[model samples]
Target: MESPSKGYLDVGHLELGGTIQSHSSKFIPSDKAEFNRNMLSRNKIISVCLLLLVITLSGCSRINSAQGWSGILVDDDRLILASMDGHIMVLDKNTGKHMWEPDLMRVKEKDEKKRAAYGLPAVSNGILFVGVYSGKIQAVEVDTGRTVETEV
Candidate 1:
């Protein structure tokens, strides 16, 4: 009965390395499982961040939908304003009451100027002329809210 070597061990016909190597192999599967769990956690975090970013962008778009950059126009008794949402609104100059918003183009149309107006509304002889950002000019009657002419 001779004693085994110091750095080697024999177990049931299988030979294993010293204490450090054998202990490390025992922990390898658990370490690998922990690493995989960490990777899954990181992926989940990234997905959550992307979802939050999309939600924030959608909220900003909704906030910007009703805003405009076109200059204001004051006619005889109405205050005219152009909205970036492609609407020309007429309100009472003094009371700020809602009067009318004329349709420049169909909302469901595929025109490039559907929701953008960058030019000031010009009023001449009861006719309001507006220019669309997508290269179209519309002449609308001030009082009747009728589109008199449309030029593209």
Candidate 2:
């Protein structure tokens, strides 16, 4: 008779009493344990790499927050305020009504530009010298919200 292969269950010796009487060489128990340990180490390394990737990508994303407060200037009866988004608005100090505002939407239509003002507005004669963050000085009329010139 020929011998059976190693690590194979012999079905002929299997009994209904849950006892297995067979001449079979058992499988490599130590090698199977080593393979399981290697797989666990690889799984741990992959998990750590994915966690680091998520943390690195989180800092690269942008979240919408409030813009900084601009320097407020009071000119006569009108309150000259520069918004953080780069629009200049003049309001009456008495009734808190909007006196004049620059047409930023129309200006954006002509040239797509982002305006940010952080410094104080300098008033000379009737013109206000506003320093924009884009390294430009905006000369606006104090009474009529007319833009005199933008010196780059």
Candidate 3:
């Protein structure tokens, strides 16, 4: 303890000297030194885990054919068109191309940064339910292209 009166004495098995005395060295296990040396590097462990996660996600996103593409409408059991890019594009009943003016563009441009239309065009009964930017959801008539319901 470097006491002026004690003369740095080792009163018991404890060496009363140096910085080691200030720390709780008695709590350390005998094998911790060897165990720490063998542990894998933190950076390497994180990198390997991230690589595996990316590979798994990419595999899930891969579509064998255009059959599963979002916004694609199927009529008479045939592919119509693929609607993507934050717009409800009218696809030819065969060629998956924009048929009507992209639904979003037709609405006057508002937000400078156009958000992606993540909504899957739903055609049921005859109405289509589509999601727009900023949590805007609308049900449009498939034939007339008029909004039947608007919910933001």
Candidate 4:
């Protein structure tokens, strides 16, 4: 394989039992050094841009996935809340104590984002209905925390 030549002048030819030499008066050592410095600075700029892009994407994911806000329903003395992580929590309205263990209402689907609750819970005829971001509605008995039905 043969490699391509650069900007050097091909002024001399090789002879049998002789040496070949070439020189270009237009080339300067300082110009080569400046070219290298320019390339280095360009690489640094590109690297910093990529790093900033990664940081921005990570921050956006944290903002979207973080859990905190969810709607709550006060049914009689019990406080019913839907957690952002796809669970139903029943708490006492007055003392703020857990009425029952938090129940798993929805789960993450394959190739989908994590399940989250975004709407207020509803109670009708002693049944609590909670809607999740995964397009499912979970119904449970508000008194016993028993599962009544689920619609997906």
Residues 25-131, candidate 2: write the lDDT tens digits. Answer: 55556777799999999999999999999987875554554555478788788777776667777779898888765433111112324476668877889997777
lDDT of 4 at 140: 79
CA RMSD per model (angstroms): 9.9, 10.5, 11.6, 10.7
TM-score head-to-head 2 vs 3, winner: 2
Candidate ranking (lDDT, best to worst)? 4, 2, 1, 3
| lDDT tens digits, residue span 15-77, model 3 | 456433432223334476556654656667888999999987887663652323345556543
Report the poorest 10 consecutive residues by lDDT, candidate 3: 19-28
Model 1: how far residue 150 lies from native, Å: 5.1
Candidate 1 lDDT tens digits, 87-145? 77778899997666532332122574565666788888888777766666667778867
TM-score of 2: 0.50
What's the lDDT for all of these models?
Answer: 0.67, 0.69, 0.51, 0.70
Task: Sum up the clashes in candidate 4.
Answer: 0
C-alpha TM-score for every candidate: 0.48, 0.50, 0.40, 0.50
Point out where model 4 deviates above 4 Å.
Answer: 1-60, 63-65, 102-114, 150-152
Which of the predicted structures, 1 or 2, would earn the higher lDDT when compared with the native?
2
Cα misplacement distance, residue 59 of candidate 3 (Å): 14
